[model samples]
Target: MLRKVALGSGVIALIPTISAATPVQESSKEPLKPPLMRLSELPIYEAPHAEYGEYIKSKAKAEKNSYLRSVIHPQVQAVREIAEIGIAHTESLLHTVQDNYHELRDRTEWIVQYLREEDNKEIRYGAVAMGGLTGFIFGLRGGIIRRVFYAGIGTMAMGGICFPEETKEIAKRNGALAKQYINIAYNFLYGVKPGDPQLEVKFPELSLPKNVSELTQLTINHWRVKNRSIASEKCEVECFEDLLFITILC
Candidate 1:
């Protein structure tokens, strides 16, 4: 009875200790975020040129006729030129990107040489069969034909080797991408139908720029809000002059 009681007491004590212990909790982990796109990787706005032109024309039309003739017209003309230059700059930038991605310089001439070589191999084989058969049939009479055929085939066969399809495909894709970038830039800089098709003549009153930076500044100025306080003040004075005169007299 004593031993059983002692063992029961020990078991009760052990149960209490086990029940008092804390449970282990797991720490929550945060999800990783997606990488942000670089400026070069971002897609440009569509029909930016058309939108820009419309914005300009709308502003111009809202102005008084004298202001439109004296200021807005020349400003529009200058902005157009600047925007066109900016488009050209964008094209060059895009071309550089494409070249870097494609490594065009490394593959261009080499791939052409390789393709020529593959073509030459086919030509050489064909020439051999044609020449052999012709010589066997007409003996010396087929000499001229055989020589001509052989010469043509030989020239082609002389090429280095066939260019790998992978390299050629990459080059082609790069070229296409470069062209697409240029087109996108064009849409952003010049509307679908620019008012002027030709820009050979420069307008000095517009303060046309000779460099890209100047052009960019001009472009920013083109879209910026104009201060027409002078025009507004003149109209306000003309409209309220009678009221002001009566008040002054009183």
Candidate 2:
């Protein structure tokens, strides 16, 4: 009986030891985490611009509650619409300016040629007067050959002496070409083909003013006043150069 009791006690002690030593079974349902990537191998991530298109789309998707989304959606949409309209109008105006510039450039080809001819004439005259090739070379320094070439414009009402019927026809053609060129340039710059309703979003380097009034003023100053003034100045400078060249030649 004593031996049996001693053996039973030993078995009880061994049972507790075995139980403690046994490895606990891992929960099968627990998910294993993916291994972390090395710092060097980690991809560079750029956050999307808050005001840009992608952010607007993502925000719409993230909101689950219908009430909150409904309130926010209209406001977000309004902002996008405003931006689109503002950008489109600005781009259209810019394209008009570009078309006008090119048209002016096309019209001035004859004057540019005359200036070039006058420059050559001055060089030759200097050579004749100074009785040496050195004088001619030096004279050519100030009057560099300005060769400006423009492709054939369909039609233009270049100011010149012409019959009444011819003048009227030229004016009509000029208007048509002006409209055509403006559309073409605008389409190319904006990347919106004919009949396409979408307006391209542009993120210019300069941030627009937060205030609606200030933004309007800024747009007017740049697109309306400043750009037109600059274009006029350019034309004036060219005309002055042509006049100077003619005077020198004469």
Specify the highest-lDDT model's number.
1
lDDT of 1: 0.62
Clashes per prediction? Answer: 3, 0
* Candidate with the greatest TM-score versus the true structure: 2
Instruction: Work out the TM-score per prediction.
Output: 0.17, 0.23
Please give, for residues 1-250, the per-residue lDDT of candidate 2 as tens digits. Answer: 9999999999987874433577889887423333555767655683223224555565566765677889899999999999999999999999999999989988777544553454465643443333333334445544433111110111111222212345457767975786677767767798887778744433345554868799888988778887889999999999999999999999
**Residue 21 in candidate 2 has what lDDT?**
78
Instruction: Give the clash count for model 2.
Output: 0
lDDT of 1 by residue, 61-171 (tens): 767677758877888889999999999999999999998867975687665565456457675455445545554454445577676665544333332124245434755
* Residue 15 local lDDT, model 1: 81
Which residue pairs in model 2 clash with each other? none
Local distance difference test scores for all models: 0.62, 0.60
Quantify how close model 2 is to the true structure by its C-alpha RMSD in Å.
31.8
Q: Model 1 reaches what TM-score against the true structure?
A: 0.17
